[model samples]
Target: MNYAYLSSLFRKQTGKSITAYKNELLIEQAIDIFKKSNKNITEVSNKLGFSNPYYFSRVFKRVTGVSPSVYLSQIYRN
Candidate 1:
């Protein structure tokens, strides 16, 4: 469950560290859930292993340039 060296190994391969790669993947999943699933913000946050909705929202917005609710609304309205 712990991958301290994967960062170095992945960085050596793709020039992107594990932390960055993992965060990118996590953010992508969050977007999928927000746009394609019935899960609420809190539920998606918990399912993604985030500490809480606030923390998840912070990270989600930081990565996607928008809030989870706003993203979800865009999908829902479309």
Candidate 2:
């Protein structure tokens, strides 16, 4: 199948665009990293293959309703 057709099928099956799904997975990984490691946001973002920390923060906020720094603070507080 072509890229468009596969993307449409993926969206129909998963109810999210491919990029959205990928970002969600990345954010999930980020959460795990935050909980288990001492790495900061930039390191996590780079480890997850994000081009830049700013974009990573944007995606993290979009998926988690909080920025990476805020999420880290919350986790670390507990």
Candidate 3:
């Protein structure tokens, strides 16, 4: 239940650190919320606890290979 043990177990199973996994999960959830809601990037960023939309867009693109606006456009096109 401790931090070290949990991080070890998480890394063993996922081959990534807990922080990386959590950030990935956050991006995935952000994608879902963006696609399903009418909120703009700044609103979505705020809702997800990001201090600013620019930082959120950076993390989103880093994790998913697309900016939030681009991702939303792609989803809408398909």
Candidate 4:
């Protein structure tokens, strides 16, 4: 019920911190949104609950190893 207990359970079940799981979920949502819409990175970032596109891009690249723009470009190239 508390933060510490929940964090422990999360680590035990998934081997990742809660923040990492949330970011992974957000990035997955962002990828789906990006693939479905023609909106720019800022729009996609905002839709995924990020206040700043720059921060969103950093997180996206960290999780995905590529920026949102680059991801979309690759999709287009295929």
Candidate 5:
């Protein structure tokens, strides 16, 4: 891999850069799976390679301002 050349390719037009973009992607996908899956927290965490459910819940809540179960409940009621 040409590290320098690839690095230049990912220098975001908005100045956020590639790492930030990838993080946004991860957080976005997490929400997608959370809403779509009937899987439990541990399953979501494991599926997403989050190491543990506690940390997964923490990150999910941080991004969406609610627990995964709570989030799922809202969707289910609608």
Candidate 6:
């Protein structure tokens, strides 16, 4: 019925907070964008509504276990 209750239910169901879930989804999108386009990390971060590229990089690393630059390098290397 309320935001906190819904958030609690979501966490119980998904084992992650809403913010974590959102960051994960955003990172997934970032990967897709990286693979499909020539957009740089800053561009992708802005497209995904991150406040800044640095914060986006932090969240991206937190979700994917690598920085955006490293992820891009890995993606292109494979």
Candidate 5 versus truth, CA RMSD in Å, comes to 3.1
For all the candidates, what are their Cα RMSDs to the real structure?
2.8, 0.6, 1.8, 0.9, 3.1, 0.8
TM-score of 6: 0.95
Q: Give the runs in model 1 whose Cα sits over 4 Å from its true position.
A: 1-6
Best by TM-score: 2
Model 2 Cα lDDT, one tens digit per residue, 1-78? 899999999999999999999899989898998888999989999999999999999999999999999988888788
Ranking of all predicted structures according to lDDT, beginning with the best and ending with the worst: 6, 2, 4, 3, 1, 5
lDDT values for all models? 0.83, 0.93, 0.88, 0.92, 0.75, 0.96
Instruction: Name the 10 consecutive residues with the lowest summed lDDT in model 3.
Output: 28-37
- How far out, in Å, is residue 48 in model 1? 1.0
Q: Candidate 1, residues 37-71: lDDT per residue as tens digits?
A: 78998999899998889988888887889998898
Give the lDDT of residue 51 in candidate 5: 76
> Candidate 5 residues 14-77, lDDT tens each?
5655655665666688778867777777887888788788887877787678888898788889
Query: Model 5 reaches what TM-score against the true structure?
Result: 0.64
lDDT of 6 by residue, 1-78 (tens): 999999999999999999999999999999999999999999999999999999999999999899999998998899
Ranking by TM-score: 2, 6, 4, 3, 1, 5
**Candidate 4, residue 32: lDDT:** 89
Candidate 6: pairs in clash: none
Q: Residue by residue across 1-78, what tens digits does model 3's lDDT show?
A: 899999999899999998888779988888888778788899888888888999999989989988988988888899
Question: What is the C-alpha lDDT profile of model 4 across 1-78, one tens digit per residue?
Answer: 999999999999999999989999999999988788788898888888898999999999999999988999998999
TM-score of 1: 0.75
What does candidate 3 score on TM? 0.80
Error of 1 at 58 (Å): 1.5
